[model samples]
Target: MAFLWDCYDAWQRALAAEFFGREHAGQAVVFHIDDDVAQTIREKHQLPESLAQAVKPHIDLGQRSHAFGTILARAQALESEAQPPRSLPLLAVSVLAASRMSRDAEIQAINYFTPLKRLLYGEGADDNDRKRDALDQSFGQVVELWQQLDRWLRSNKGAFGVSTITPDKFSNRARIGYPLSQALARLADRQKLTQFFSDAEITPGKTYSSAYLLRMLDAWTNHGRKRFSRRFEAALAEREPAFASLIVREAHGWDGKVLDSGGSGHLLRLRLAFNHKRARLFWVAPIATGISGGTLTSGGTEIGFESDLSPYYEGIERLPLTPASIAMPLRVHGRAAAGDPLVAKYSPQEIILFREDPHLGCWVSQDSVEAHEEHLLLVSPEQQAEVRQVLQVATSGFVAVPPPLFAAVLPNGWRLYRNVCFEDPAALSRVSRRHTETAARLRPNPIGRPKLVGGLPVLKELGSHHYLQGGAPDLLLPAAGDGSRRVSVSLGGRTPRTDFRATGYPIPLPQDMLGPGRHEISADDAVLSLTIHERVVDDGLPLGTGTFGSMAEEIDNPAITPLVVLARRNATETAFVNCDGTVWDAITPNVPQWLHRRRVLENAPLYYEIRLEPHDRGWLIERTARHVMAIPGSPTWPKEDAILSAEARTDWAKLILDVTAPPKHVLWPVYVKIARKILNDHSR
Candidate 1:
């Protein structure tokens, strides 16, 4: 895409150079000025005499001064006539004058003229009595002058040669005027001001009405501050500690019977505290085994929580625990909805606290599973006993492993090896060997000249298949063992027609007799071959039949004149024929066979049609045509010719010739009349 764009740019540059000379072509100049300069220019139009006096001292510095003088002269001429001067020249001259001033003077100018500038660009004065008085006192004339200048600038912007200035260039100049931080601060301030007041009321002001003040306060309380706090809370909730605390508080009263327990205790309750370091919500369950040495001990299962629940905690200090709230599924070790026994072992009781994150479900722990050190919470011994008693009662009828029970059941003579790691050193090597052998078995057989298949005397590769339009190719059939048997063929379940006498070596199969369906051949009781033939289906309109009149009717009521004119003009080149049996002369000697057949047999079958349609810009010429077949003979052609009178042919030819080189006056009114007709038809 980049290469294409480069080629296009090069082509454009070459064209420009060829037409306008290389020195002037491809030379684009862009000017950049600060917003302050734009404001100064606008304000100067309100008080041109003062602006001209201020810049007179530095006016003779360069050719720019002469340009400024010319701008002033134009301004005087427009003022005498009570019209505004062109904005582009005034803007350019103002920038030149501002650049010549010292930094201190520029700042002073901004401060001194701000009040008068505000009278023109500031909030509406009519809305407030005090503002209205201020506007009328000293800035009334300035306001009027500024409005006049702005109106003229907007109306004649193209005449001033400033139409090419785009918003992007203005934004770039704004960016270059101030440091990033200062610009951002200004933007933020503007957003706040706009939030509190309508755009018409946005301006620098030392004082605001009590009504406006109250509105600003309300906006800050309900929108600005609340929005900031929510963002801050969301940011805090991303950390592990804060998130863990949120989960503990939210699930304080969650308790339910687990589903699909697989002999493990299926009931559980969430503990109030959270393991902040591990970012886990702890739970309690009854031990699966009896106590040993007066202490209850059982390993716990550990699973990681999936899905980020931080967004739910934002703004709300704590979530409400209810059955209908947070009943989501959990991902056991990041596996959800898998049938593996390890992952599907237990369905933990749902934690109903807040709206569930669709992707993260509840987690459950079963008895006898060792808890990893990193996942274990430092709970007291008494708490563990209490949890065990609660779970034991919950699982009284469930299966339980006795104390000191073996981890795995073994055969009679077998022994267990503790703390031993089993490793397969040649695992990858065995896999590589297996893959190599499998690939060799799947490899394709080498190609050789076609050979005959078994006792049937047919090639193995020449099996039953489908052939398209042109029919199947010739096939050589081998002779029978006795060297006297004949081959017979039938098509589409029909009686056998053609028969070939068999000799010994080979014979060409009859392909012409087979078309579009199953074909069978047999020497005796056994079927020697079968083939299916088919042609590509065409779903388009038939060739040289769809006409302009039909197509125009197809469109919702189209105009008829432009279409008629165009039809008359291009009649000789198109496939359509007049109703009077006068056909268009073929432009080329090699006319398509289908078209020729359509003209002769169908009595001038119409192929191309034209219509005049109402479009957004005006009238449009719409042309429609059917596909043309280029084959030699038309399948539908008849044996006779349809002729028209010589008088009719002469009249059509003259009409066609007149339209071929129609004058603009003749063509335009036809288009207008067509457009009017289309509008009138649609209105009706």
Candidate 2:
């Protein structure tokens, strides 16, 4: 029973394919009627009594005329083939008998039409065998019709309207050639067939079955009714000649403002002019990066521009704006005056007004500032504030400033300040402080020397001195030394020391002076301070060989001692050393040429001699040293009398001695007194 029903369904589809062409005929034949038409038909007419009784099955109003025409044509064709001499009421009888027979009686009724059956089925033997053969023969005919339709569809590939298929003379073999041909031509001319079944959606080279082909046709027909061609042509008419030519053949749809064109996977958004006289279509996909001035090709024509519009396309997608609600300024200045009014307008709620520069005139927001070609403006202060608030939200937490209108009224220098200010005052303050600190850190140290007392180091308050945190202090000394300078020293009080050396000579100083002492030594001339100390224990060993007597016995020993002596000069220090087998040479007196070099006085007395004690092994030295010196004339004595009167010179000498003396040396106070005396003498 199911097999019979399946055969019947196939039979109907085959008939539909034969009549409507394979393109329009779907899997099943269905007749559609408008609701209003159906209602009107029911109310206007009633079926005749005889016809109603003869046709007991429900007759589809929509398919009635097509079915009648098909039956009539089939009967006439059969009669013409038979060429019957007596036109037996055979055609009428066959129709009536077939309609009256029930499903169970269908085989017998077919057998009754023996002559017709024989004509259709060739020849048969027994009655039962003949009936079965006749049914197979009938199904075969339907199958043959299906094959014919498929072949016809394939042969007339040009009817589908693709660019590859050229048009040829068409034969209406399937009776549906006209409508199919017309649909294909319309689809080809409008260039919508390719868009409907894009490469991404359907595979190329694969034969679309009859059912699938029909579906595509249905979609194409429905899309046509949308009038995409008319809309596209209208949009093209509004575009510039260059841009319109590039996409003249492409289908497009206008969504009031933007004219959208291209196929399924790719699309171009053409912003239309308000007057519908011009348009600008931008390339959307594969957004060009770092694109400056270039030309984009569409169809065959190239549309050239000096700036990139990919950002504009992306901005629209990211932040869509309502076309009708965009704010337009009553007046525009600078480059903005020449821009499209519609394009210039933007939603204040989406963008803030940034200051206009010579390069970027009237930009919309911070993001828009990068692409300076776009001109945007805010009409009023209220709108500017609203835009600022909106920009704040859009930029996460940044404060956006609207361009000020009162720039001309502001103070001269203040006009150069940024229109936008950072919201975090503390952050701005910290940045300022950081810059100041960095500048100070990079400044070079002052060029001055340390003031010394009695060949001992003393920290004196100099006017505005920069106290360096790390490294040894600088020392200053007069260039010419007569070696006659004598200054008593308090050795125990914070006296610096040098590390022990094997070859060192230990000064046999009294142990009583080793303790802290308070004493003053006067010097007429400047004296240098030399501090000796043990090498830092962690510095390992000194470089040179040890004493000859000790080196042999302690060649493998890890406990060798080293000593270093630091000599102080003006803003600089030199190191000297003495060890068991090695002694550092005397300090070289080659001063920088920039300094005033002076020669030592001939036969000058030996001012000081430093000595160290030896160890029990005769290699190491005891941690003791002695200092000897002689008094010398003041180094500043020659310049003093010339700069000051005789009486003032005496006073200056006394002041210098007091300042350079021991424990509480008051240099600043004594220097001030001498300066006053010099000024008074000069006045006289």
Tens-digit lDDT string for candidate 1 (130-185): 43333224222222332344354345532321211221211223211211111111
Across 418-535, the per-residue lDDT of candidate 2 in tens digits comes to: 2332322233224434343221111111111112312222121111111111212222211111112122323234454322211111112333332222222112111223222122
RMSD after Cα superposition, model 2: 40.3
Model 2: runs farther than 4 Å from truth?
A: 1-397, 401-684
lDDT of each: 0.28, 0.26
lDDT of 2: 0.26
- Ten residues in sequence with the least summed lDDT for candidate 1: 367-376
| Shift in Å, residue 301, candidate 1 | 36
Instruction: Please report how far candidate 2 places residue 191 from its true position, in Å.
Output: 8.9
Stretches > 4 Å off in candidate 1: 1-70, 76-84, 88-147, 150-222, 225-684
Candidate number of the best lDDT: 1
